[model samples]
Target: MLPPFRPGTHLVFFALLLTLPSQALAVIDRDALDTAVVDAGELSRTHTLLVAVEGETVIDRGWRGHATDETANIKSLSKTLISALVGLAIERDIIEGVDQPVVELLGDRVPSDIDPQVNDITVGHLLSMQSGLQRTSGSNYAGWVASPNWVEDALTRPMVGEPGERMRYSTGNSHLLSAALTEASGRSTLALMRDWLGEPLGITIPAWTRDPQGIYFGGNEMGLTPQALLRIAELYRQQGKHDGEQLLTAEWIERSWAPRTRSVFNQDLYGYGWFRTELDDTTVHYGWGYGGQLLFVVPERNMTIVMTSDPTPPSNGSAYLEQVKAVVERMIAATVP
Candidate 1:
């Protein structure tokens, strides 16, 4: 497995880590980098790796017969896409801004017996996982999804913390946002995703799991090809623009990348649906899904990378995520001026 990182220790000593000077285009050692990827694959069951620097594809490899063009279940990386849709909805005036009350958007799905604090939960709270409602992720995910109505189940959940406080990292929070988008726009998240993002980005997003109430699984089980994921990363790297097209406002990109709070699991700073961390010394904003699915945008390095791993195996408690982070570190270090 890839090496573990101490909480406060910065990785800046790898021989290649400091090899690259402060120039935009650096010649990467392809042979060494490819060998590093192979070695990392042995540590983690990585299926694909796609790297682009300065708008050019530098590395694209799919392991074990997996094709780079084929879509893989991206799991919770879908949350990032969901967050983008939310931003579009706001800009289009589908609903109010992030401060709009979620309970109001949810309407009847909100149980009659919800805590008074539930009214305090807003779209922004849900986006940042500060809904204060008991999380529907982790061990609670099974029960949350198995409930008769996903929106009702999430809305009725008791307030464990104050709204807009610490991060809870709940998929239910995102699912509730999906339901809100549906209610506000009178469209399925999948359909809106197709028109709003898929069409603009020219990426394929197949239908994923839907809840009992027919709301798309907001933060989980979605699928995207590695190339598609890379494009999404590149969009963020270019500050929400692609091919001279402004798909998202630069303000929204800044807000999405800005750290609102920190995740309790990894202690990484979190924004709307992205995680902020450091790879060696460069600040990396990423979207991480279950089973090692990751999309990383390194703004400083002008790099965007996508890595997809097998979703069948458990990743939370395994070394898969750590290994992926380690591999990304190597990739960043390989750049040279």
Candidate 2:
């Protein structure tokens, strides 16, 4: 038989145990995070770094006097925004599913003499960068943008491979998506973005560069604040829900994250507009822009990180990109238990 003794003795012991340090009570180390931010500050090109874990921002630091709220050109990171718009467009039924042929929407823009294969390109092909069209990003960027009709030029470019055959990173593919969205919705891409995302996410959607046809540049030169970018990342991290509303469908989020092709440059898996790769043994999905504008989502950690860098030319090539990724890896390590 157990004796009913004084309860104070047991209660005192339990209280003492609660005060003792335990791994179960461990929280993110702020000092380690501060050190990581210090290291990021040393990168000359990096302007801002914002880190959020579990939907709460822990660090928002700006380097070289840059403010986190300042808008900067996100470069190819705009592709991710375009992808989101496409997803939202589909959800609204303005555009059909990904399988719909893009030419169905842009048929008016297709050149008369273009190859018949152009008709085979679908919305999914453009989102995954598997449109098989000649790239309009690197050396051809100058000439492509200089053309009188950006959409027509992109559609008329020679097919380098079969549609949906392989990933061929091209801004033109993204621009074509913008045009299709415009035609299907009977609204400018900017209007769709402002109504569907900007207003819902409560982020400013500044007007960006427009083509000669007055279409907003799709995959490049979209200006967004780092804080705004973080909110966008969080939206995806939350599987397209925001403020108790399903702004984007969970199905669309899953489809956007599903690996559709491989990037030849870095060997990273390309989904709709995000790139998947391993960092510090953790799977990371990121949106990379020219000159190091980066948005990373670590689903395993419930983390979303944004880094904005100088958009000037001479990107220092992949070497600098690796360095920026290392900075992110360090931040992730700092959060480990």
Candidate 3:
């Protein structure tokens, strides 16, 4: 059985927190770095790790039984993927805008028995995780599905705060976005992603779990290869273009990174569907998930790092992100003209 988690069913994280060098560390020796991470505690038992420099694969390693094309469930990294699709839907006029009141969008789904402030929430609020809805992930998830319509059940939640008043990291918000996208486009999110990202980028979609309501589960599990995650990051880095064509609006990419929430920790910020941060002044936007699953896209340095893991506690994960950031820092130190 899976271990316990804190708020939001965090899926947990555990990374070897490294002490920063009194002096900057050296450059990218792909082989040396891979060996180092693999040697670090249980992180060494990680299923997969992929690193890319510019658009080229620099390091690729797998556990005893894995491969380049093999897709693994990315867990919550899919939230960021869902965020990009929301932008594309807006670009296509699939919906009026993210600010549209969600209750009107979903029709009868809002429980007739629930509070009316549910109607006041907007699509943007949902995407940014400011929805004021009860987090529907974790142990609450089972009770969620046991009911008839999971998506509707989530929307029925009363406003915990004025819309956009506070930051509450809830996966339910993204599932609502997926349902909204389905309603707006008249197609499933999976099909839309297949057409927009998978086919265009020559990528694959691994296994995905769906609710009885037909909405994709937002956080827990969505499969993807590390290379696929890198492509998704590369697409964002290139401002949502692929092979010379614009797949996502440049303004959306720019707007998506506009920090809307401040992190309790240093070196991080939250935008619409993206996370923003800097390491030594170089900007890195990334998606972090339970157990350290992530795609760290560093545009200024033209690097991307992908990590997937089994859930670990916060005491262990506290330095995990910083350690990954250190990898980029050391690699950046390696590059000098």
TM-score of each: 0.90, 0.91, 0.82
Candidate 1: lDDT over CA atoms? 0.85
Q: Rank the candidates by lDDT, best first.
A: 2, 1, 3
Q: In model 2, which range of ten residues has the least summed lDDT?
A: 10-19
After superposition, candidate 3 runs with Cα above 4 Å error: 1-45, 263-267, 311-319
lDDT of 1 at 2: 28
Name the better of 1 and 3 by lDDT. 1
Residues 198-233, candidate 2, lDDT per residue (tens digit)? 999999999999999899898999999999999999
Candidate 3: the clashing residue pairs are 12-291, 27-334, 73-223
> What TM-score does candidate 3 get on C-alpha atoms?
0.82
For every candidate in turn, the CA RMSD to the true structure comes to 7.3, 7.1, 10.9
Put down candidate 1 lDDT per residue, 1-337, tens digits, no spaces.
Answer: 2256556543321222222373344556566677677876675568888988777787888887787799899988899998899999988998789999987788777788889999999999999999999999999998998899988888888899999899998999999999999988889999999998899999988999999888999999998899999988988888788778889888998899899999888888999999999986989999989888899998887778898888875675325666788888888877643
| Candidate 3 per-residue lDDT over residues 1-337, each given as its tens digit | 3245456541222222122333222135444454555552235325667766655666677765765467776666788888888888787878778789877666655667767777778988887778877767655766776777878788776567878866677778888888877776778888888887888889987547888878777655788877788788888767777777888888988878888886554347888877887765777788877656778777665567776655444424436656665655554444321
- Model 1: number of clashes? 0
State how far residue 237 of model 1 sits from its true place (Å).
Answer: 0.7
Query: Candidate 2, residue 88: CA error in Å?
Result: 0.5
Model 2's alpha-carbon lDDT is 0.86
- Lowest summed lDDT over 10 consecutive residues: which window, candidate 3? 10-19
Q: Give the better candidate number (1 or 2) by lDDT.
A: 2
Candidate 2: Cα lDDT at 187: 88
Candidate 2 clashes between residue pairs 3 or more apart in a chain or in different chains: none
